[model samples]
Target: MAYRTWQCENCGFLYEEEFGLPLEGISPGTRWEDIPDDFVCPTCGFAKSQFSMIEI
Candidate 1:
């Protein structure tokens, strides 16, 4: 599956779907939109609303 990447608009933190956050219980290949809304930026405390699809 082709995974996409997202960037935190608040902090420029990148969340790559190919390398899911194990600490957050998100397995690899998880989609950006599939991530729960409660999930916050690891670097900044911004919510999912602050993230945008990014081309890497």
Candidate 2:
């Protein structure tokens, strides 16, 4: 299993998810790759590029 750290592009909010948090927000059966590009940051509205992969 690979855990990744994702940061919000706008507010820089950091969140760690194993399978991956849902683009619509933390929910059941959420995959990182499944997240939509338009997914806005909970803290700030930013695109996926704003987020980067981090070593856990």
**What would the TM-scores of all predictions be?**
0.88, 0.60
Best by TM-score: 1
Superposed model 2: Cα runs more than 4 Å off: 19-25
Worst 10 residues of 1 by lDDT: 28-37
Q: 1-56 in candidate 1: lDDT tens per residue?
A: 68889999988999999998888899988888788989999998899998998899
In candidate 2, position 25 carries an lDDT of 60
> Which tens-of-lDDT digit does each residue in 8-56 have in candidate 2?
7567676666534556467644555766767666677777678876664
Off by over 4 Å in 1: none
> How close to the true structure is residue 4 of candidate 1, measured as C-alpha lDDT?
87
